[model samples]
Target: MTTSQRWISTAINHALLLGAIELEQTDRGTRPHRLPAAARAQWPDPQLLMVEGQPSGMRLAFRTTATAIELETIPTKRIYVGMPPRPDGVYDLLIDGQLARQGSVSGGDSLTINMSTGSATHERGAPGVLSFEGLPAGDKTIEIWLPHDETTELVDLRTNAPVEPIGTNGAPVWLHHGSSISHGSNATHPTGTWPAVAATAAGVSLINLGFGGSAIVDPFVARTIRDARADLISIKLGINVVNTDAMRLRAFGPAVHGFLDTIREGHKTTPILLMSPIYCPIHEDTPGPTAPDFVDGKLSFKASGDPAEIAMGKLTLNVIRDTLSKIVTQRAATDSNIHYLDGRDLYGEVDSAALPLPDRLHPDGDTHRLMGERFAALAFAPGGALAH
Candidate 1:
């Protein structure tokens, strides 16, 4: 450590953390989790465990006079067995509420997965330091947004000057739950995610519960949302359920109703916006159990379920959207705060033609930005469902 630098352990200062639902005390340091310990314990699927710890909307916020800062973190990066190595997760630094700089940590733990075999291997590596030097002098609010896709355990935080936690700023909190699209798949950075973008534009604090492949309307997830403090709540459904083929029409409707029932148990009159899936040509009409298609060395996804089965209750994007719309309309009769939004309105056929999803499933960086802008306009504008 440098002679002028004062090192601070995140383990001792819990107040500096923001956006995470829980802070897990790890062997290396503290790891932020989007899901609570009890919820995680209830459903310990490996995929859910990894995504919940990725900290999509989590960041470290403090007020400091430091001219430079350094953070040591051990990040668990994911790797596919055959595809090219993914780039290191980007760390975005905001000074006085504006993005000022970006950085990334190099080597750390790696989790290699063989998707075809449904197997993964973890390799431990040394912690890497992310350094941000030569900041503008004087007291300022600083925020370090961690990687949205990586599981990071913060080891140390060091700065050239004294730092103090920046407590709640009295902004309304928006709690959103969805699948990978909201979890930030293929987005360049954490703030680039649609939910983050919408939160910033809407002038609300975000608590993202967007797990990649794990947003299948689990009871525990609904219970977590029931207990959270939120001024606005949105649940983007359909994509994960269709892709995983976890439920059929017979069970999907009641499962969603039950999920909403649990949330209403706590947030009786809070505005709830229920959204369906966006335009994905591959799954729009086809049922899934989506499967990865590494065609000609490039990754893509294809629906594997037969279309004929959809008549027998297999869920498709179209079917799910219709179901969600009907459910919301039926509930809005007695409950005025419940609302429904067609995900296609956010990214419809027109959008698909203009900015096609690079992977036939997840949107690209540009699309993410576009979707965020569209959502902000649709939901946060005056006379909108979530408008204040």
Candidate 2:
């Protein structure tokens, strides 16, 4: 280490961490997890385990007078064996609450998955450093948003000047839960995610629980949200359930009710917005187990289940949306704090025409920004459901 540089222990610097529900000590450092250890212990699905550890909305917040800063981290990057390589997760640095610079680390570890075979292999590599220099003079609040799509283990924080925990800005905390789109699929960086964008615009603190492919209204997830310290809560449903064919119509309604019931037990009268899935042509009326389509070496998705199955209670995006709307409406009769939002309002047919989903599933970076802006306008506006 340089004589002028000092190392900050991430393990002991708990107050500097944000958006993570738990932090587990690792051999090299500490790994931030969106879900608490108790929830993780209940369900051991590999997909859920992986996505929950991705640290979608996690970041480090501190006040420092440093001109140069370096964060040492080991990130686990995921790759699909047959498909094109995914981009390295990007780290966003914010100075005084505005984006100042973006950076990324290379050569940490890789987890290659064979989607067709449902098997994955992990290879370890040395940690890399993300360095930022030439900050504006004087003390300033700094936020280093971690990669939204990668599992990063933070080793140490090095700076040329002293650093201290940043105090909260007195904004309401918005706890959001949803599928991969909300987890930042295809988004260029962590702050680009819709939840982050909306949170920033609405001036609310964000606690994102959007697990990729794992937002199936699990009881454990509901319990976690139930126990969280949130001033406002929003749960986006339907897409993952339809795409995974994880539930039939008969079970979907009760599962959602149960999920809300569990949360209400702890957060009585807390503003809760229940949202449907955004427009996705492939699953709007058709049922899924969506399967990957490799047409001309380009990745896309196709609904593998028969549309006729909907008559027999098979769940489709349309069905799930209708059910969710009805569920929220029913709950609102007694619980005035509960409300419903049609996801189509955020991203509908016009949006689909303008900026199509790049993979016939997830939206691209631009779309995420659009969605975030729309959400902020709708939810934070006067007389809006989430308006104080």
Candidate 3:
């Protein structure tokens, strides 16, 4: 079998298989294209080598703030990445970054990062950040840029390159799911994905389920996430649910209930964080029935679902949240384990200025970095993995 196919098969066979991911063009390539020969030897860890093929021009360097972990085990945390623009068609995995067993690029032809699936990213345009963990646990800078093309120079001045290490645990697993925003569109590389940023800030594992326009509370997705094991977990709802215009009020309630219900079935008591959605001026408080061509200035939208349905208050995020609030309130009574976090809290209107998504949909890497740090502060505590 091809290298990419083998890795996909090993999804079950391999325990360390990446879990969370936000994919674009679900029907794209199974893996990224091959790496430039030189890049192969350099990027060895999966944490860093997110593009396709081999790990050539890639290198690791670091800057520390508090204490450092003596750079051991591929400084997994905060592995930064940046890539030049590419045609919006298909591509392959260039090279293997930090931790790689064996994989390929261009499986589906689409480009994205399956943070949990051990997949590679297909560059959209420009250069952005890529992150790694296992840092020395101080204010550290890390960068990992991969692109075999001759016209790209990836660099990270704000944060240091490579990364120091904290030398703890295995590596935090990050699990995420959302709409196009979460799928790494417009962002430069897999490391630039918000989940990646968040993963770095909080220093935990990631399992991104952020499908480009597919996070409509699919029972299968929930089941998939529930079954996957990880040290941390999160789900970004609202935007996708509302944007897709999936379900009405009645259905939204049950869907949320079922989604969480299934997750609880698997996670039970794993600090499951339920996030709302970020601020998109066009759809902030508006209802859906979202058809294409709805715009509030430069902000253009497709209304997501059926407007008639939204008029009924059945397909709006507000309505969904209200229902979720009620469900969680009640569920919290019995299921104290489940936690609800308003998505607005993460990226509300006020944040629109400081952390603007160049396209105004997803959060940029810097914002993602902030969100991750906040999440770690709120979700994690001193020493232990989860919050008390």
Mind giving the per-residue lDDT tens digits that candidate 3 earns over 223-305?
A: 66776665566677777666656666767777878998888788877766676766676566566545434244333344454
* TM-score for all models, in order of appearance: 0.96, 0.97, 0.57
Tens digits of per-residue lDDT for model 2 on 271-316? 9999999999999989999998876789889989998999999998
In model 3, which runs have C-alpha deviations exceeding 4 angstroms? 1-17, 20-169, 289-311, 354-357, 381-388
lDDT by residue (tens digit), candidate 1, 1-388: 4666665544325478778888878788887888889998997998999999998988888899888889999988889887788888999999988999998898889999998898999999999999998899999999898999988888888877778886557778899999999999999998999998898899888889999998999999999999988889999999999889999999999999999999999999999999999999999989999998876789989999999998899999999999999999999999999999999988999989999888899998888988999999999899888997
In model 1, what lDDT does residue 21 have?
85
Query: What lDDT score belongs to each candidate, Candidate 1 first?
Result: 0.90, 0.90, 0.47
Better of 1 and 3 by TM-score: 1
Candidate 1 C-alpha RMSD relative to the actual structure: 1.6
Error of 1 at 157 (Å): 1.7
Best-to-worst order by TM-score is 2, 1, 3
TM-score of 3: 0.57
* Worst-scoring 10-residue span by lDDT in model 2: 5-14
Candidate 2, residue 99: the lDDT equals 99
